[model samples]
Target chain A: MFVHGLATNPGWDWPTFFQFFATRTIFSALWVTVQLTVYGTVLGFVLGAVLASMRLSSSPFLQVVAWGYIWAFRSIPLIVQLLFWFNIAYLYKELSIGVPFGPEFVHFSTNNLFGPLGAAVLGLALHQAAYAAEIIRGGIISVDAGQLEAAAALGIPRIRQFFRIVLPQAMRSILPNGANEVISLFKGTSIVSVMAIPELFYQVQVIYGRNSRVVPLLMVATVWYIVLTTLLSIVQYYVERRFARGTAR
Target chain B: MIDVKGVHKSFGDLEVLKGIDLDVPAGAVTVILGPSGSGKSTLLRSINHLEKVDRGLVRIDGELIGYKRRGNKLHELREREILRQRSQVGFVFQTFNLFGHLTVLQNVVEAPVSAQGRKRSEVEPYARELLERVGVGDKADVYPRQLSGGQQQRVAIARALALKPKVLLFDEPTSALDPELVGEVLDVIKELARDGATMVVVTHEIGFAREIADTVVFIDGGRIVESGPPREVLDNPVHERTRAFISKVL
Candidate 1:
């Protein structure tokens, strides 16, 4: 360990690395990164599933609305969306839940309604949802039409049929692509630094700005991302295996 | 008991069934034989509302299959109601569309326990009994992919029987199986016929139809060309179209 430390000690950058690790700030920042990823992915998945269902619905209005959501979100850059949501106070001074174009039952200042963390999660999740929706839609569509026909002929309720038969099979196709989105989202969390959220990357930037150990502190953030993504990849493998049960090779 | 009247079905520009009419009484086996693309399958699918008729009605046990008759209008049943109606009429497909992710037993017990709202414990034994009767009892715990074509088809039969429907429809059940495995599935159908289950079968197998059919209906160009007792239709077809089709197959 002494020899390795000696070999790696370039301009005493190791001290900054050690200092960053020893402080509670780095760990808290790491927590923020995890929170954003987990919540973003989960919320994104729910919205994506709903959007995919809408896209597949018989109603033309729903199909168009779903299509517009996906097209708009996916077409806009993630950074632009983050900025737009973070500065949403400019567009609407107050957020309210009440009748449209009528009296407001309740209201709150937009700036107070959403903080930086909320804005980051909202931007990341909504953006991820657009891509996730298509992935899920493709998966649902890829299932054999015969399966639906069979389920219908068997008299299984439509909702039950989708959950029991269709979704299970669809998972076989959805998992691989869904895993891609999750891993991408994990790394994508780094972009939240723009909002001054003080997540891992942002914290690293703050530490290096004070200490001037730029490259090494950046490496610290890089290593953490690689480690987290590697662990996530391992999880993806097992999840795919579980969903692939009873399916033909 | 199933009744089909003036059932017309068209796809795009091609009319598949041009006003078909037939009646299948309780405990009778009606075997429909026809050449490919002759709309025999379409006719079979219409009975259970899998294929809606453009102009006509299908009645099962004195109830309209997929519509609620109100006064002078027939409103299409909602999905939930249609599902409830379908649970009482079992169907077996040619390709054996068993749920691949489910085990044989799960496939059989699914419709009964979920759609029919029966308890799992209550349905399990009968599901196993159906599997045993279909000759796939030992394979119930296995996935559909792990089973042979014949085994999968038998599992499908068991699945349909689990619903305890008043009538069962088979659409070329053996056509998708290998020749060597065909008899296994045919044997199960033969046993069902002997038990006097009401069945409507659309198939190309002349021999199997001859052995089990109470009435053999021949279809050509989306119309029933000839229909009668097995011997009369199979051995001595009067219509030239039926004769030509039988001649080609035999």
Candidate 2:
């Protein structure tokens, strides 16, 4: 009865859903979502790797700095962080590149430089970095100390040891958790809708608001998210297999 | 070719080695035997600079290990330099520390290629030869986890030999192996000894030491209680502590 009602009901608007699904506006909005996810993941993981190394370093100052960053970012909600970045112009008039406490070399007006999209990406990356840092550190520490000792005893260069010996082993532990964070971030990109960036979720809201076809428009966005997330999961599977080279039974 | 002079090491308040002085001539097999917590491993590790000495010097072929001698002071070598020095001194642990991510052949080839800067093409054939020598040639493409404990230990030995190290240090290489698997690893080490490799081994195997060791040094309470030819130290221990320890192990 539910399937028959949905198929027959005029409110289902299957024709309108099909018409708008392949439209240029919705496709462009999806492109925006893709950009956000890609930029957020790449930048977040890069910063996270640096933070993880800092946390693992012998220097107390680096450890404290990494701890403070993770603490502060994690404490703030992602939406609140995004809102703050969106209104950063109110907090600071200009961002600059210069020596500390010295004359500015170049400056960019905050309002002009960080538009809605830039603010969303920046907010997502910074928020994602905190979680990524912990994941990476957990992976590194999960590797046995004996592996490193063996590498060092063999006189492998320190850099080579980290890349060849430590990283491969760490990835075996890191992949599942890292993939979780990425999938979360991909879905989390929808939160940028509040900043008025026309990503997939915001675009769907816009179409339903105009045409009053809420359920069908919502279904379109849901299907796209499922398809993309499935692709990401497939990629994660292959990457995990690559790192799990030796330990497989 | 290995010289350890007045080496003293402590971990916090526990002094592991108390001014150890020993010398192993070129091409000699020196076996260190001691009860647990007596610092036999510490002394063996000190020879390779795995455990840095709080006081004293270790030299392999007259080059100070882990330090460069300056004007009356010892400056610790940078990591790169220390690594280059370490490439000359191979160490095998009680736990067969094979690179688990790498295949048996890759584990053997990694150090010689990456650490010593040998060509992979050249190292590959030589690595297979070393694997064959160690009796793991058939398992070359397999990971360390796929092999038995005895096979893994043999691959580790092959890895150490790939570097053509001046001295090889074994810290209870067979201690972690099953009783049934111990002989295979021991036979390999005995062969290395017969080939006149300069090796310092720390083991509880009294029979193996007597058969393979040129010098047997028995340590007790962070000091060498007795050391001489294998028969003298094993059969006719001069010190009462050595006699007691030997009797227990025998």
Candidate 3:
């Protein structure tokens, strides 16, 4: 009972873990987590928007390419993809750009191309883009067919029709799901700990490994995740309310 | 003026408009009367290239609807060019397809400001005047869903008129309204007719057709059975199909 008590005791574990949390290094780790989530989700959204538009485009070749990308990324696990990207230096020694079947115009060694942090962001953003594309496509499709017809009949140009007529309405459908994606992506950033990227979760793992106190460090990470998700939910609520105007109650 | 010559359209194996020909003279109210699934709407939609015809031509004032005539081969115009042509042809849909997110005034001003690149300040006064003329002046800032079916249709008319289009196309404008709400919409159309607006209306409203149409065309099975002045075609039809249809509707 005495040994069990020492292992499980909150007072001992929490105080020791709190000392690590108070260190300036932990704050830097937290910043890394914030940066990864922000850059990852923003880049994901831009790529997702393009993929969704491509999937819905009239051109068959574009449709096939978008479909293939979404299928491949969505089918693979994010953790495996992260590891693959982290170890990509082995898969391809270098990346280069040039005219097709012509001399290389620019070259970058794979080892110099992406660090652990870059690999983590690339993995998460690519994975997030697959899901985001589907979400955005669903939102765009949810707008009534008649709305498109009405815009076409009114002689509004395709670009203006999308921006002024379609996208605003699509956003009404998109915001709720998009907010969920953002929150989920924030939590999913913890997966980067596998690559030793020194984000919040990675920092917690390091602290626990040093002190041999795992349970309390896990609790700290959980508390931070809950706080982040709650903040995201609040933002989602306000955005939804803004777009909900003019729609019937 | 609108001209549809040898227009043919099909969806899968089902032909919707079969070698159809129609001519709507300038400043004339040509009402197309038909039963459901008789291809009246298809013919109307082809005028502005909403639904591209498989064969033949749709020309507005001798200009091709959605194609550029380079010799004899009809090349489809780019989407941008098609959009520019569509602005001159106002279409009021059966369901009153107003931009639901927009206020009534926004719906009216969208085409002139966005499509024609007209200044909002210059377009706004005319937009307001059109709304007032159509009896929806006070409801400018209100969204579409808040308005009754009749009020919404009136706003749709005002929106169409905002473009000051070369021709107005109405595809069963009053059919989607409540029975009690139908008269307000027909009244707006009657007003447009009185002002010598060129229009092609597709409707089941027999009484309104008799009152407003200069020419009445009865269609069945994707073919125009009879067409003449409303009094002659509506009251004294020459074809058996027209007589049968007029009997059932009236």
Candidate 4:
């Protein structure tokens, strides 16, 4: 009886689901989600690498600063962080570029500088950076210290030692955890629905609310997420194989 | 042509190398033998400035190892300068610290091309020749993990030789090898010795030292007890500590 009810219920509007699935609205919303993830991941990891280096540096001040950043970001709820960024114009009415504690070179209203979408990307990248920093730092430390010692003894330049010897080894450790973060972020971009940004989840909500066919519309969003995440996993597999060069038996 | 004068090194509360003075004449083999924790390895590392000395200094061919002399005071060299100095001094570790991600030929070619700025075409031929010299020429394309521990050490030796260093320092190169695998690495070192390469080795292989070492130094309790020709230090009795240690290893 339950299976019959689920299959025959008027809420199971298969025609509407198929109609909306290929529509430009849903596709455009998905493109927004993809843009957020790409921007967030590329910018996040770049900032993360810098932060990881700072944490691993010999200077105590840099280490503490990186530690504090990771601690702060991890402690705050992601939704709350996103909300704060979205409403940043209320916190600071204007943003400026200038010498610190000196005359401002230029300024603009904060609302003009950051749309809801821009704020969402900024929030996601900054949040992702904190986790990426720790993941990268762990990967770096997991490599054998002797690898670096050997490089130094051979007089390979310090930068070359890190890029040629240490990074290739560290990537073998980093790829899995790093991919996990990226997939999490890809789905997590749906959270921007709170801002009414019309990404995949938010667009699905808009359609279901208008037509009052909630269940099938939600399935549309869910299936899209699974498909893209699977694609990301496939990409991760090939990347991992490349880094596993001499290590595998 | 390595000179270590009054070298002292301490790790926290324990003093590892205490007031070591030695001279490795150009084109000669100096073997340091000691029991575990006797600091023989520490002294060898000091020659290459791998372990910075607490006091005193090392000089290679009249140039300081990790410092520059400005008037009467000595200032530590910058990392780039120290790296340049280190390029001239090759070090081989006990665990065969070959670059595991690289093939044997790439391991041999890396330092010459990147560190010394030599052309790749020039370094590659020489690298292959070094691999052939070390008896692992056929294994050039394989990664270090694919080779046995003995083969890895030979590749490491070839990698070090690619730089054509003025001095080669080996810290227990054969200790990490299997009993049956030890002879191959020791044989390569012996061949290098025959070629008049300057080398300082720290090892427990008393037989190999007697056969290949021009000078054998016996160390105990972080100090060199006695040093002379292998026949004098190994066979004749001078210091009781040297005699006791030699008897046990023999």
Candidate 5:
């Protein structure tokens, strides 16, 4: 750490330039990266499952809607979507969290919700859901009709069968694909820097702009992302193994 | 406990089952033997509405099948009403369709717990007992993929029995098994017959029909050609088609 600072600026004391941020901004953004991934992944998975079911639904209207969504989102790159969502024009009205019939509980608008951190997470999540929908849809179809009949024969209702019998088998088909989505999501978070998310990429840009240490600061951001995605890959490996049980090795 | 009347079914231009009307008694084993494309399997599937019949009716325990909840012979019976009733008529396949994800114990207990709404804790012991009866008790914790062809078929039998069905249907149950594995499945069926369970079997196994069936039904070209006590039917057949089929297999 000391040598890196000195090498970047040798004329004066380097720690003065480094101490201001070493103790704060980069470290703070590290926390933001974690939060972005956690919140983004959760939101994305919930939305994606709904979208996938919509695509799988027998009704042509729903299938067409789902198809339209996937085509629009997946075709235009993730980086572009992240930027668009962060800007004012693209956002819908802010979220209003309230009881449906009773009373207005709370409302938060677009400006407030798209804070540096929120924008990053939201961008990654919405984009990720489209791909996840396709992954989940494929998994659901792979399950045989006979198995559903057997479940039906047991008098197990259709709704319960989706969660219980169908989902477990589908997990085997979906998890590997889902792992790719997660990794893609992690990469997608990089786009958040343009939204002023103050994530690793943003912090690196800030550091490089001030110090003219472009290569080193950019390298720092690159290392962090590599490490994080590598860790996610490890997690994915184990999840795939658990779901793939009893299938051919 | 089961009746079929004038059941006709077709697949596109190919007419599979042409006017199949057959009756099976309470607690009796009825074996259906026929050539390929003769529609024996189609006729059996039609009874449960698994394969829809263009025209005809199936009655199990006096309730008519293929009718709407309000439209037909039945005053009421939900789609699930039909499902629960159909659960009472278990169908075993040539390829054991035991759910690959679940353990043998879970497979055996799934219907009882989910369909019958029996407590899993209450049904667990019964499931184990059925597994043991089928000689797959040791494999109860194993998944279907982990078991042999014989073991999987037995687990399937155990799965069917988990429902404690009124009439068990076998669609060439042993036909998919290897030569060595076929005997184990047959032995399980023999035990089921002795226990007085009603069965409708589609099989090529002449000896099993002779040994265990109360009645042997020979269907040729979607029609019942000869049916009687197994010894009588297998020994001396009346129809040329039945005679020809028997001669070919022998």
Candidate 6:
């Protein structure tokens, strides 16, 4: 119904575009992308910090296991990780969901996490956790020996010592790198479209299908990506500033 | 107030301290004087169990410093228990190991607030007064790096005194300070001596030792070669090692 740059490209249609982007479907896709970024990064960071602590374990066995997990997950591409989980259900006939060796039992139909929204979340979160663990470990080790010794010398309880003294200081050192990880993770969610989870990229595809103007539709998706990344970066700077007090000295 | 008996220490095969014994009476200044490898700092550190002992025992406030009983056998105290015992005697390090991330006030209040379970409300005022006593009250809110070496060491002393310790240990406290700034920190130690808190100090300052110390001990090659009143030991010299050490410092 509308034409954009009519003189330059007589076929460049643009009138329905303003109304097209404002449609509920496009808006819902934007919200889904936001949810993925929020939940995925949170779950990933929590699991990653714990794993990083375990990775620094004194036992060789735990170290080997952690090393193996990081190597196996990180070396493969995220697209491959998603596909492997999606297809793995076909390989295994039975899906047993029960408390192992704990007198509890439940069973599920063989539905491996693939193609489903939950599977996308699970795949992204677990894969991100591997990289997040290394980031957290680097932050923790960057704190000086004197700070930990000073905390221990004060006789704070071991758990309290970590949260209050160790973690705050480590957060200051870790946050710049952590913010970058968050941004990368946000973009990484786009890979989920390959599995058909109906995210932002999927919505963009639907628009292009109705009116096959591929470049402009892709441009709309690119604009949303830039806006989201810019907003996240602003939040990151403030969060980093809050934690970095007294670190200057 | 403190007793170190037949204390032996080794860093693997190095044998940093050997069968050292000494008595520190309550409310008197004891200055330990020795050459670079004389184990002077090691002796001062052992009194507070900062440097763990290989054999023998240290007793402070009549409680054994390092050894604990386990099914009728003695074992080194656990970390938690070690902290409780060590808190009674505060140590000042040569390098002024002030927590760089904390302000002077936080550094002073840390041990009392966490180690002793004393309220910040009760400890903060006393810390401020102690900072005034050491003559660095103005530097209270400043971080350690912002202060001069002398000012930092004075803050270190204020930090030590914040706990109201029974005996204060100084391990070459002024050794790392510039020559001019040394007097400011030493002057505070001299005042602490006048107040009669049980004090054990290791120093390269012959003049500070001669002025404030009640007993002067000379150590060489991991043993106490001689000990007596500062006048007797520093002035008269009982052994060739003591004579040579004092002659060079004097």
Query: Could you say which candidate leads in DockQ?
Result: 1
* lDDT tens per residue, model 5, A159-182: 777887889899987988887777
For residues A148-203, what per-residue lDDT tens digits would candidate 4 score against the true structure?
A: 98899999999999999998999998899999999999999999999989899999
User: What are the runs in model 2 whose C-alpha is more than 4 Å off?
Assistant: A1-13
The interface RMSD for candidate 5 is: 1.7
The DockQ of each candidate is 0.82, 0.82, 0.80, 0.81, 0.46, 0.31
True contacts kept of each: 0.82, 0.80, 0.80, 0.70, 0.42, 0.20
What's the CA error at residue B53 for candidate 4, in Å?
1.0
The residue-level lDDT of candidate 1 at B24 comes to 98
Better of 1 and 5 by TM-score: 1
lDDT string for model 3 (A1-249, tens) is 887886676655767656665578777888899999998999999999999999999999999999999999999999999999999999999899998899999999999898888888999999999989999999999999989999999999899999889888999989988988988889899989999899999999888888778877877777778887888888888989888767985
- Among these predictions, the greatest lDDT belongs to 2
Stronger candidate by TM-score (2 vs 6):
2
What candidate 3 gets wrong by more than 4 Å, as runs, is A1-23
Q: Is candidate 2 or candidate 4 better by lDDT?
A: 2
- Interface CA RMSD, all predictions: 0.7, 0.8, 0.7, 0.7, 1.7, 2.7
lDDT of 5: 0.81
Clashing pairs in 4: none
Model 2: per-residue lDDT, tens digit, B120-218? 999999999999998989999999999999999999999999999999999999999999999999999999999999999999999999999999999
> Chain B alone, TM-score of each model?
0.99, 0.99, 0.98, 0.98, 0.94, 0.97
The order of the candidates by DockQ, greatest first, is 1, 2, 4, 3, 5, 6
- What is residue B250's positional error in candidate 6, in angstroms? 5.2
lDDT of 5 by residue, B14-84 (tens): 87878877889898889999999899999888777777788877888787765654544434346676666
Q: Which ten residues in a row have the lowest lDDT in candidate 4 chain B?
A: B42-51
Misplaced by over 4 Å in model 5 are A1-23, A88-122, B66-79
Candidate 6 C-alpha lDDT tens digits along A135-166 = 89998888776566545544445565677667
lDDT of each: 0.92, 0.93, 0.91, 0.92, 0.81, 0.82
Binned by DockQ into CAPRI classes (incorrect, acceptable, medium, high), candidate 3 is: medium
- Per residue, candidate 1 scores C-alpha lDDT tens digits across A1-249 of 887875676854776677676468888999999999999999999999999999999999999999999999999999999999999999999888999899999989999988999999999999999999999999999999999999999999888999999999999989989989998999899898999998999999998898789977887888788889999989988988888878876
Give the lDDT of residue A138 in candidate 6.
Answer: 91
